[model samples]
Target: MVKQERAARTRQALIQAAAEVFAEEGFVTASLSTISKRAGVSNGALHFHFANKGMLADAVEAEAAKAVRLITEAARAWQGESLQAVVDATHELTRSLTHDTVVRGGFELAGDTTRRGEPSLRTQWRHWVEDSLRRADRNGALAEGVSWSDSARVIVAATVGFEVLGGDDTSWLSRQNVTRFWEVILPRLAGRQDLDRLVSSGSRPSAVVPSAERTSG
Candidate 1:
């Protein structure tokens, strides 16, 4: 049991270290040795956890995908309007991008043309956004003449843009920035009744605590 727990910790640490290295140095340039060193583990330990750099990257992307799923799920759990749930999820996502190295790295990797794989993180997010908007439409939360497809496209583009820009300047991931974006779009996206109730600044304080803090706490 102790060995299993330690192995889990080692794998997690390697994933996190790989994320940091990949985020700072593009996946193509990041070295497995660097990731292993960053994790404070020997190269043999890293190899035991991940066969190669691609495997490590995959692990990082998977961890990030989990975080995104949790954020969207939490947002949908909200008791308020569906559109409001979208807004809340957007805020949570940006918060994760800003504070979570794994998330940020995974997003970066998703866009990295150097790597190719099935259903990147960006695809996952886009799909979720589309599904959520579709739900909102069924709930009559969207404005007249607004198609969920168009709304989902715009939201996905804007959020992905923020993620790309935030790589250089984290201000792009700021709550204020996300709030301002929703403030401008929610009026056009939400139905009259929903618009009045929707808070462009998010419905609650950010629940995306840093992964390290979450694990420790």
Candidate 2:
């Protein structure tokens, strides 16, 4: 039993260490040796816990998903908020999810993947984001006449763009600089009117666009 508990802790440590390193450095440059050192484990131990680098990457993604799901569940569990409050709550939830290190790292890794295909993990993230938007729309927080499913898709796409391009340029995510994003995009979405109330002052500007992209210049 003690051995099992120790193994679990070691696995979790590697997951966290890998996420941190991968997010800070592109996947190509992120080394298993660095992750092992960061986790305070020997490289052999890492191999024992994870079959290979790809397996560790998968574990990192799983940790990230769990972190994001927690934020989603928290927003859903809010019992007393009104429709506007709910939208506001969801907005906050998404912000936390986006900023989460584990969740954020998965995208950084996928972004650096050389394979010319979709990562299955990306579909899950998109579905989660879409679901959040749809829930807000169904609660009547969004304006009428907008297609919630499509709007959710667009919002998630826009979010990905923002995260990738806005890297260090938080200027776009600021209230003063990013209102243009809403000016151009909000009308197409369902919850603009409700969001106006929820995000009246403290709205997150936009997703942070990635800065210093290693590739895709």
Candidate 3:
């Protein structure tokens, strides 16, 4: 039992180390040696735990799932609140997921055609977003004429769009961009207008999540 516990800890350490590196350096440029070094493990130890870089990437994604759960759990805490509060909470949950390292990384993974069909981490994510929005719909948060599924689709897709476009050679995605996108989309889903007045454009925020959340597989 102790050996197993230690092994699991080692595996997690390697994954966390790799996640930080891969998020910062991009998959193509990231290296096992660096991951091992960051993890404070010998290269052989990382290889023993993951077998290969691709498997390590998959583990990194698993970490992203935990991050999604963090936001999902937070939103779920609003159990029986008012429709507006619930809607706002649920909207905040989606924003949390998008703003997270693992969830954002999952979007980049979903967009990668090569990685798209490979167990698609976004499958869980898509379900989470769609279901949460559906809950809001049940609470009458959406516009009277709007379809929850459609609104959910639009919100998820737009978040992905921001992740794709807002990154550059110097940075990953911007939190301000993601947050602004959230503020804009939430009003629309609720059938309210005034996106232009939410905040002035061209305002950028500091990085919050890991870059892997914004980069592709």
Candidate 4:
């Protein structure tokens, strides 16, 4: 039991170290020896857990995918038939990317051409947003004549833009910046009657209803 626990800790440490390295140096340039050194684990141990840099990258993508799912699940659990859940999820993601190196690296690696075969967090997120907005439209949360595709494009572009910009300047991820984004877009997306129900601050109540449904794009 002790050995298993120790192995688990070591594996987690390696994943984290790899994420840090991948975030700083693109996937093509990062080296396994550097990751092992950062992880404070022997190169042999890293090979035991992950056969190569690609496998380590796969692990990082999986961890990052888990983080996106948490934000998605939390937002989906919100009580309402509105796009508020989507807005809240974007806020949560923006905050995560700003504070969590794993999440940031996952996104960075997702864009790297060399990591093509691994799961794409960017694709998954886009699908989730598209699916959620389609549901919202069917549920009457969207404004009359406002198409879900256009709304999806706007939201995805802005949120993704923020994520990219934040990499160079963290100010892009600030609460005020994200809140202002919601404020500008919500009016165009939500019906007049539903406008009052939406919050530009992207705040959600603490309650979440777990659902087993999952989506893959």
Candidate 5:
């Protein structure tokens, strides 16, 4: 049992180290030896966990996907299928992009043209945003004549833009920036009545449970 636990820890450490290196150096230039060294583990330990750099990148992206799911799920739980949920999720997503290395690294990897894999993080986020907007449409939360597809496109583009810009300027990922974005768009996107209930600045953090605790529970 102890050996298994240690192996698990080592794997996670390697994943984290890889994320840091990938984020800073990009996938094509990042070395497995650098990742293993950053993880304070031997090259053999990294090899035992991940056969190649692609697999390590996949693990980083998978972990990031899980975090994204948790953020959207928490928002939905807090705000149901309303447009407010979409707003809240976007805020949380930006927050993660700003503060979470795994998320940032995964996104960086997704955008790395040198890497051949699909941009799983962006695709997952786009899907969730579209689905959330669709739900809001079904709930009659969207303004008249505003199609969910259009709204989804605008939101996804804006959020992804923020993520990309944030690589050099963290201000792009700030809560204030996200709030300002929602403030501008919510009025045009949400139904007249729903607009009053939506908080462009996002809901209280406590209202949405953290992904880590949610998963453990």
Candidate 6:
């Protein structure tokens, strides 16, 4: 048990170290030796955990995907078709990107053309937005004449734009910015009657759940 726990910690340390490197330096420029050194592990240990730079990047992306899935699944598990849930999830996603190196690196790495086998984080996010908006449209949460595809395109584009812009200026991911975005977009997308039901502040009950509780549960 002790050995297993230590191995898990080592792997996590390596993943986080790689995320920091990858987030700071693009995939092509990032070096495995640097990641191993940053992790305070020997190159052999890093090699034991991952075969190469691509594999280490894959691990980082996988951890990031786990984070994204947590945010999206929380939204999807909401009781009904809710644009509010989507709004909340977007805030969560942005928060993760800002605070979590794994998520930020995953997104950055996903855009790298050189990483042949890695999944596209943007594509996953776009599909989720499209599905969620379609569900909202069916439930009459959307304003009349608003198509889910159109709404999805706008939301996805804006979300990615924020993430990209935030890389240089963290102010882009500020609570004020996210709330302002929802304030501007929600009114146009949600039905008049449903407008009040949405939260522009990006608050979610799920936000109150402790990270340890979430990870354990």
Overall lDDT per candidate, in order of appearance: 0.88, 0.60, 0.58, 0.84, 0.88, 0.84
**Candidate 5 structure, TM-score to reference:** 0.94
Model 3, 42-109: lDDT tens digits are 98888789889888888777766666555455445534322233333334434544455545554445
lDDT of 4 by residue, 98-206 (tens): 8777889899898798777666887888898999899999998899999999999888888889988898999999878988998888999998888898888776654
Q: List the residue pairs that clash in candidate 5.
A: none
Give the residue spans of candidate 3 off by over 4 A: 1-6, 79-113, 169-179, 191-217
Candidate 2 or 4, higher lDDT? Answer: 4
Candidate 2 wrong stretches, greater than 4 Å = 79-99, 115-121, 132-140, 170-197, 200-217
Predicted candidate 3: what Cα RMSD to the true structure?
Answer: 6.7
Residue 103 displacement in candidate 2 (angstroms): 1.8
Error of 2 at 69 (Å): 1.5
Best by TM-score: 1
Give the TM-scores of the predictions, in the order they appear: 0.94, 0.69, 0.67, 0.91, 0.94, 0.93
Candidate 3 yields a Cα-based lDDT of 0.58
Model 1 segments more than 4 A misplaced: 79-81, 206-217
For candidate 2, lDDT tens digit of each residue in 72-190? 45445542232332333334433543455666677666677552264544566577656666666666756678776776667567656655654556443344333455555555553
Candidate 5's C-alpha runs over 4 A off are: 117-119, 206-217
RMSD of each: 1.9, 7.5, 6.7, 4.3, 2.0, 2.1
lDDT of 5 by residue, 1-217 (tens): 5998889888888888998999999999999999999999999999999999999999999888888888888888878998888888988898888767888999999998977568679999999999999999998989999999999999999999999999999999999999999999999999998888889999865434253552233
At residue 76, candidate 5 shows an lDDT of: 88
Regarding TM-score, does 2 or 5 come out ahead?
5
